[model samples]
Target: MKAAVAAILAGMVIAGGVSAQTAAPAVKEDFKPSSLNQPGQQFPQVNSQGYARFRIVAPDAQAVKVSLGLGGRGGTVLAKGADGIWTGTSEGPLDEGFHYYHLTVDGGTFNDPGTLNYFGSTRWESGIEIPANDAEFYALKSVPHGNVSQVLFPSPSTGAQRRAFVYTPPGYDAAAGTRYPVLYLQHGWGEDETAWSNQGHANLIMDNLIAAGKTRPFIIVMTYGMTNDARPGTLPNFDVKPFETVLVKELIPYIDGHFRTLSDRGHRAMAGLSMGGFETKAIAPKNLDTFAYIGLLSGGTFSLEDVNGTPGYKDKVKLTFVSFGSRELEGNRAGPPGQPRADPRVNAEALKGAGYNSAFYVSPNTGHEFLTWRRSLYQLAPLLFRD
Candidate 1:
């Protein structure tokens, strides 16, 4: 997510909506098929330095461009060769972690045939992974794995059945009567329930955390954040009441009745990223009785006034975790040109000074992207439900 994006997205989600090149060292010859590629397909490869090289076959095309790399440039333009194949390398190394991109082939947009698809920009686009140095924390090791299951719960407010993904920790089924804490995680705008599981790998992160005994086992519930109402860049006009009703009145009841959750505010948590973060900042403070732990990952902030203004924030909110990408704080202005940027660090400090349970974190060397949110979750998880 860009700073401008986070600015325009501050109001509501409303349903639906880069690394520097290394020194003159030789490009490591260890490029391999992107982890996101389909089976037996290769071409979109990333070297150890995070440079992505692409080869797209277009026999009868005029132009081919990969919509990634070099945040400023219009993306990498591949040159046609004698063999009718178009190939190119990113102008510079990309930031580590998953990115959604598309191919602009001869003025027509399409997905790269090699890589798997991820839902972003309200569509399924090609995804690529530039391995992160700290990827091991979310890697699938020999540790016990959890299962992510899809569920359909009825929502009287929406008058339709809504879908959500549930993550049951390893041994959750066998343990039978053991109840676990719950985290109601939401995705950014232009994403749905699958974003956290497929792109963010929430299950893997939790599994690794639990296997190492770094954090207690918990259930994660993810659903479409009801952001389809307003168009992008018009989030301020979006209404959050409809979505809040679905979550508070309908979905929580369904999860409590079906899953072996602790079913209490003390064991329940809520967090989101980007527009999802905006949602969290909006709902969590107002409904402290429902969510004991609140986390805002590159979403927004809870100022001293926010805690002071809310009814039960001081005693009810067990944890107030605020985080952002180190890069997201680069500029003096955190919002648009006119709006004054609210300093999250100051707010966090003030909250703590006032005897509130507040924690602040910054993801190193990342932007408003999944790498930031992933690290935020890893840090926030350990602090949640401690009471």
Candidate 2:
């Protein structure tokens, strides 16, 4: 899946707020500092309508533009003000949830000095938050939170120790002899292990779900999807076996042995977004004994043909959760090039028709952004680790 995340993000970042912003009332004046902003900064703000206003202080710079405001024509261009600060509003309203962006100052790319940084496109990019109506699901609440710890495991395949974030649910320590199911989550292309917790809020989502009694308690393990082997736009020749070996051969055993997990086929699952989704689709069906549940978020679809071809998919697979933002499925364009163009909805329906536990979901009024994946995880978590 090397560069696959980059490809998906390239196409996704540009499709922002295209259909969302329409002929409407004036942009609301209720702009508040982005939730992702640094503690004391107030430059980048988001209004109730999801319109983002940016303020950059670059007294000596000739030009400044925000890479995340209204895609296509070089994002939103900022005008120099009398105060020597650059300011601009997004050309259109952006989708709700987190968006990765950067500032172009005097023809050079740099992170927005105001907002917090997130790893995307293989670099630290500025991030902004547009509050979602269902944000409470992933929001930090008064409930007990899960622990996200970094683990260094020996990976003989790569000849080095690999790092992964392990999310052990709250009360994990109390249940001394109780073993839990495991979900091996993968981050998209160009992104590493941090994407799930840092950007997607996987831990928070799980905490809220477990707290509310909406889903069964399960451990979530996140790691890099091994996408750096190839550069962006070179996904055509990407190989899944290398990453599959790392995940199945090394990560699974290590987790089962070290953590109190139900190390069985029925208790394990795999899921990802974009390139990570692609990885889940490739690895799960073939390794039925390893993963019983599969999910793809704005990733690719698994046709009935794919299910029939995989030897034990029907018997071992428990759920096939397919999801995308309503915008990504516009004109039935789900998967990118190098994969089949079958609409995920149609494929999902086909799976259900063929007696598979397939669930399809769409995030309304959004594109291929984090909002899409966040909702996907929320919808998927409840269906996983179920016997």
RMSD for each of the candidates: 3.3, 2.3
Query: Candidate 2 vs. truth: CA RMSD?
Result: 2.3
Overall local distance difference test of candidate 1: 0.83
What does the lDDT read for residue 315 in candidate 2?
85
lDDT of 2 by residue, 144-164 (tens): 887999999999999999999
- Candidate 2, superposed: residue stretches over 4 Å from native: 1-19, 332-340
Which TM-score value belongs to model 2?
A: 0.94
- The candidate maximizing TM-score is 2
Worst 10 residues of 1 by lDDT: 8-17
Clashes of 1: 8
lDDT of 2: 0.84
